[model samples]
Target: MLEHNDEIRRVKISVRPLVEYVYSSGDIESGFRSVAALHEGTRIHQQVQRMYQEGDLKEVTLKTEMLYADILYQIEGRCDGLILLEDGWMVDEIKSTSSDICFMEEGYPVHWAQAQIYAYIVAKEQGLSQMKIQLTYIQVVSGEVKKFVKSVTFSELESFVWGILASYNPFASLRLDHIRRRDDSIRSMPFPFDSYREGQRKLAGAVYQTVKEGQKLFVKAPTGIGKTVSTLFPSVKAIGEGLLQQLFYLTARTTTRTAAEHALGMMQSKGLHLQAVTLTAKEKICFQEKVSCKKEDCPFADGYYDRINVGIMDMLSNETLMDRTVIEHYARKHQLCPFEFSLDAAYAADAVICDYNYVFDPRVSLKRLFEERKKKTVLLVDEAHNLVDRGREIFSATLGKAEFLELQRGYKGKNNRIHETSRVVNQYFITLKKECGEIKRKLWKELPEELINKLDLFVQEAEQELQGIGHGDAESRQLLLNTYFAAQHMIRISKLYDERYVTYAEVVRNGVSIRMFCMDPSFLLAQAGKGFRSTIFFSATLSPLQYYRDMLGAGEDDYSLSVASPFHREQLDVRIEPLSTRYRDRESTKGSLVRLLSKMVRERQGNYLIFFPSYQYLQDVYDHFSAENSDLATIVQGTGMTEEEREAFLASFRSDNPDTLVGFAVLGGIFSEGIDLQGDRLNGVAVVGVGLPQLGMERDLMKDYFNHIGKNGYDYAYVYPGMNKVQQAGGRLIRSEHDTGILMLVDDRFLQRQYQELLPEEWKE
Candidate 1:
């Protein structure tokens, strides 16, 4: 047990005062508690203000801190409201409650503590001796309102706040001690790798420079350079140097997460006593086979905040690397919600390993981690090129009329409010269908603002009805909840909608739907890059660094580094067959492609991978080649390969006494990147076509849009994305210095100057 003092008080202060008490355990119950509460409150407040023209309410302030004893002892709490009292000094605390406020009496201790905290802050700030505090609780389910008001002297409020602070000080002191110890441990940690490779050293140097300059860096380093360790080693050093306090290793896929974990483990093995946690998606990490995230059903979720502190303290004291297995072990032991436990652990972690959504997606971004952009934190976006599409999907929203119609029918008799709200949204979709003239074709234009405004109005009504219901009607309640999220998503997307987005309507089985599809995500990508302390976007094939930098939101002021592949030029046999595999020429070239691919594999007596633009193309060429070369073993990518199937495919590529093995895989699929086939496990790669995307309205529209922006529209929209797949396919050939392989590009376009210019320096003749 430690004694708490004024120094502990200074360090223990909540960065987000209003949310300090909410606890990380609350996140497991249902997403982010503080953000959810704030969102719900804002929604209700907006509705109430629209209905009633009372004196307008305004934000008082946030994270306001007041010194009680010099700079050591302080009182801080975010003021949610500072009501303009026509006469008296009134401090308002707006609360969004799922439970019926009428069920609670006037003197609930939780309510009192909340109001008292606000009153103390207002009284201190306004130089008032006494203040009237109002606790405005709006039922999130019912839209019913309740108010609890009381007047207390500044001295009394001070005493009440001091009591809460006294209890919190013990926890604060413990956290500070832990942080100091962790930082001290990190300071003495050694570089995990015995020797850094040339490429690794270059990448590490770039990361350090980026941090030193406090600017973004886009690095293009080939695979096998130990990208994760190269980036992590430098980032951790930055932490030791007090340049950064936290590092976020964000990845696009699960397989990549394992690589990050492996890298961290290497560092840990090298005596780095850092606290790092890898966050698994809530759906995957949930203890329950299927997660509902309701309090009654989940013992871990019920009263999570009540036990979270103990769980957090216990884990912090006993563990260093809180990986999923460690987290699950601790969570089960302490009866803590594992999903929420991971999030809580992340806040205290020196580094976090997780998916891109944890940082980039608005719906799922770790709100607590990014509260202050200027905070000493660094984001290492892994496989960053994936973000171009992933970001668009995250920021865009789609609502089908079918789901609303089903909800309307489901809730018609039992839940009138919910059913009515569902009907309103359904009607809006119906109106949208009418506006689209019953066409099921893709549209290439901007979404109508008026339509979005109407949807906004519908969102308000649905939110109010959902709030009125609270948590009673399970099925109908869920429908409303889904609608609420959809509406919120639309609201976010509407803000970013511009010429880059194409408005398209589709009709499927008598149902008409409209979408504000993102034709190109470059502009939106640039928007997300803003306000970060720094970002490093690096990949093996950011070959034409200028194209990636331009599309990846790299500013002119942002630094760029291109590290060449360390492997000797002699190791890779790069060949370009001037064969036409263009969409128009596919029929004529199909036989030639199979013959060319067969010859490449026969010449190289080892496992080979043939990458096609689509499953159809892959199957077509695979069938033709398999028919001709029946002696060679072939594995083809199916609609969805199970774990066993994927294993069998890789296992076929034996390293010892390797035979001719050809695996047909689609470009830009899972097999393209992250998989390691070192030495003789894989030898040659034959990439069919330029790997351009299928001719779709979206791709065409993207081409036109970029052409309008003073760029080569075809390359921007089609050629580059296609070439990315081509490059990724080619990258599979080389795994290590000992690995010698051939890369055959089976497309005439690769021989053209426009496409040829984009080839990596090492590949150029």
Candidate 2:
């Protein structure tokens, strides 16, 4: 006979009554909630810090529970910090609130119950028979302190804990039921799609085989191949096969997350049962603008673990795809900290659809997933090429002397330790600035390891002081938080710090210092790629597969696939006019370029997009073309266009009784890739120049670097990137089998063998 699982056994007795009885709970928007509390807290804290002296404050440690377990049976329910106290054993829970705290009385049963749990744990840990537990509430505004205390024996505390547990059992039972069903569903689930495309099949087979064999596969499938579903479907099947347990669908942008969600929805519709979650960015998803994770500032963050287990159980049992809306609904229903709850839920999920940062970024990788990495996990990287740039930003750290100088001034008179640390960091930057000799930019062949080491020591001291404080002291807290993030960033980048990265310090102004830096992300990306069982990097414009594969760190053993465009070659009228539009030739060809654009618009009856190499070029053509054919409706790209404006720009193109709608946009900008202008809505694309990035120091350095590596320096630094932009822009013209459009290359470079060889077979003439 099969016995109940450990989770089932735990939930049976732990479910509490209060959670058991609630029905049709109101949904609290976590993002808004966090933002509100952050705003209020930041405002109040700023005022308090301005008026208060750091030396006047005393550090307090209110010992509550040594081991506190949630009444909910989830594995994440256990927490060590029950209740914290300031000096005089005054239990303090600092809360930042956007609303009145008058409704929360001193002896509220729930509040006391929570405090009692903490007290019980603290007493047991300290071997005390009785203790006075104080509930100190700090009003976010006015900095008012309200203290409530009650003396209770260990027996009373035990009774109170038991009561809370009894109130929580039903919700636990509901969760267990869902988990059992979800696991069962996953065990029996089949391939969701009725039939897979050829590219989808090949990619899926490779992913599954890789997971089974415990190796890596690098795939380059083109667009329209349903890469998301292809990758997800197999990972789900792997779950059923007991070869893998979790899948992380990582992407570069928020827009891509929806596609992952949609793919999961498709699987769910086919009777496949699994938990899939999309993690919104902390800043964007958080209800509060300035997020401080302590309970006193935000109720959602308060006693977060107490209700988290029930929240997780509730969500997993009822929903398959825990997208933002669904997660928010359940979080509100159970009064769980939505952000933390989402993270916890992700740990238990079968599939996690999130940004690449969640998995690859050292500063933000999910801690819980570390255990799942080896057993059964596969990473499906969408738009893998974007990882090249994204990885650099993630692995790079920047620090300014001005920030440390400001901090030194803020703490100089009172905190010797903080002041000394800040001074040390400030002086280092000063010395670095002096060495640069008034030049804003200077590169070091090697990283300044000694400087980094000294910074690390300072970070260690700051962290130690921060840990000692426990809670409160707004000014010190902010300083510590800033330093902590800085330290974390440095620590993350330190691992990848090498000769490939240029370490340069710049002087912004007198007494103001900054560091300009760059790290070769390829090696770091390769490190991230190693943890996954396999990765499929598919895009419409990965024309030069070797370039992408090399930069993405694909090994020789990794499989590569290139699918030919499904659309007929004849459908697109590809024409390359050998007319120079280079930077030097622009002035001479200005008239011809405008004439060419005007001619394309006149010849094309419907929607058309003309991509320029730079914003200046785009504006120049827009001005000339508008002056020549002012009557034609046109939208030119600006530095920043709101979502509504972008929608309006695309909406101007109509399929019925077509009128010429010309849009001028920079290559590789917002209008490129991800925007779908299927069929008649878009009929043609005219690309100007070679789309090379401006000739600058960075480009020159990259060229030199590649030259040393025995590769084509110009191609690596300029031509490849330019062509990538061109290919992506050209991809917009053909989206489907029936879609017919015209593609005109306005630059003479495309006619050259070097550039022409880089073109896709379908575009080669």
Candidate 3:
């Protein structure tokens, strides 16, 4: 037994975390986790466990304490199984692999280290001096097993434990020092701003209390409340109080991530010594033209793990603000992959600023996060209104027929197994398309298990070929890899298929595309956020709290808050044009909308934005408005604008501009909510419609699916979401107490009872 003391900290670590840190080294593989391989691994583990004798114990929990220098390292984990031998016991660790087992000579040293550690614990517990540890590798596709055994004396195991501790101590000590300083700085830190807005402290206090109590919070504070700072400050304070270990500042837009970074900077100015890292998308930050992670393809990925620790130590020691530029600099200097380096630093960071995908997307989430770690973490979701649709899109999966058909042709004579699997999957879609007849579309309430079965089999066969791929078949290899990803995703999602999901198949010009559309992502969202200490969902537009609460999976005990606007309602001059901007009425209303936009700008010579529901509407309105009012200078938001273009669009709304600038952009677009244009920079905003999503198969499917349950399908699928965007677009008008602007609601639907009730209290007033 080891005693706990203040002078020496106790590092309660696990064997897996220790070995994974010191041993696991490889190139950054660009692929999704194989669902088939994961399931097969579990099955193989069970098969091995079943073969254990009566005296053998499976999943034996093990723990041991050792003193290194002055720090007590307490490591605990469960071994796969413990087998009783005639003279000594053998510690067995089972593994499954897609690649051929014959290629593995003695297997990975990491596997031996893992089994050796478990053997040490069992020997220490039984007071034995000798132990035998075994590594069992079961080939996933072939079911062939390979075994390697090693005998070790107790002194050798003890030496091994000390060696492991020596390697981990530097990182552990650095973290210990940082936490001490971080807690001290947080304790003495004052609010970064000279004074808080009227509702700011209230929101901050609510966030702290929610995190302390380990409960989710849904907050609706009006714009200009300094929401980012308000939420982040409390979460940081919670970290200092030992109520939380990590904070994930999740954002829906790149612009909002900047807001979070700015907030952290402000806090740092107030003597906060916390480590925060911002994760940029791989495509945007990668130095290479294409995102190939092969060591040969990219120099940064070569020997990455060998240099990552040094790079992380240097980065954490010197910088508190590890944004993209800073991260990239260190990565380049140390020859480490920037994207992987950022993720590595994030695990050690006190806070991480990244897209919601890093935390919520099943396809791209950081899988290394365990439940124990999550229990000590809090999620501060920024611009949370965008997450509803984002959540749905993240959970859905689509597979096209063309990819499989091409695979069938590409591997016809090359590999019979691959060719046959591709043919079978392609034939299913062909029959599916014909079954739909003239409609050319079909919907199924349940997942087609028959299709899932074929995909599972195909995935198992595809993995075998993809293991030792060559450049000669680059085109075919890429196609198979892409198709494998698609199949695995569908197979994974099929397990979660419920009433909230619908399988839809549509015949397109190229081929048939099938999608497992997630209608309401609330359940999935809830599951993703389950083990976290707390999740603070704060936004300027979380109106009709009941609707959002239901859609976001808020529980009965989960807190809800609606903070009144600190700015006076009188500052916002709201008006209802009562004009039809519906799809059917858009042709006749186009001239009216353009005229209204022109007249609204002509009234006051300041910057203004007119938001339409779609890009086409914005273009049509812009063409007519520009042709009729040549004197008015206007900028139109184009589809797929580059980063510089987006910045230019926002820059066009300058406070120093002497003339009127009417900017036309789509509702729920890049500029609507995230951009900040304080004071006279932005004068007014006109929302063209209720912001209903265009009627489509997905939307209609969602409506029907929700209706089948006990909820109002139309409101869930359309009205509530549309109204939320309307509020987000309108939120641009009033940004500060000193700011005053006009908000014109162009559509007559705004006057309807359903839409009227959904508007925020301040907006309605």
Ranking by TM-score: 3, 1, 2
Query: Which scores higher on TM-score, 2 or 3?
Result: 3
TM-score of 2: 0.75
Please name the candidate that would achieve the greatest TM-score relative to the true structure.
Answer: 3
TM-score of 3: 0.98
Q: Any runs in candidate 1 off by more than 4 Å, and if so which?
A: 1-12, 15-19, 22-77, 81-90, 96-115, 121-131, 138-145, 153-159, 166-171, 434-439, 442-446, 449-454, 457-480, 643-648
Q: Give each model a TM-score.
A: 0.88, 0.75, 0.98
Clashes of 2: 27
Q: Candidate 1's residue-wise lDDT over 556-584, tens digit each?
A: 89888878788889999999999997777
Per-residue lDDT of candidate 3, residues 1-765 (tens digit): 122336777778878878888885776664434454556777889999999998999988899888887778889988998999998799999988887788777968788888889998989889999999989988877789899888999999988977888998888878877888888899999999999999999999999999989999999999889999999999999888888889999998888899999999999988899999999998999988998787878988878888888899999888888999999999999988899999999989999999999989877888888777899999999878888889998889899889889889888888888999999999999999898778888878888898999998899888878776632287788788889988988888888898788888998774898899898999999998889889999888887788778878899999999999898889888999999988889899888888787778888889999999999888877888889999877899988999999999998999999889999999988888898999999999999999988888788878887788878999888888898889999999888889998999998888889999988777886
**What would you estimate as the lDDT of candidate 2?**
0.67
Lowest lDDT 10-residue stretch of candidate 1: 27-36
Task: Provide the overall lDDT of each model, using Cα atoms, as 2-decimal numbers.
Answer: 0.74, 0.67, 0.87
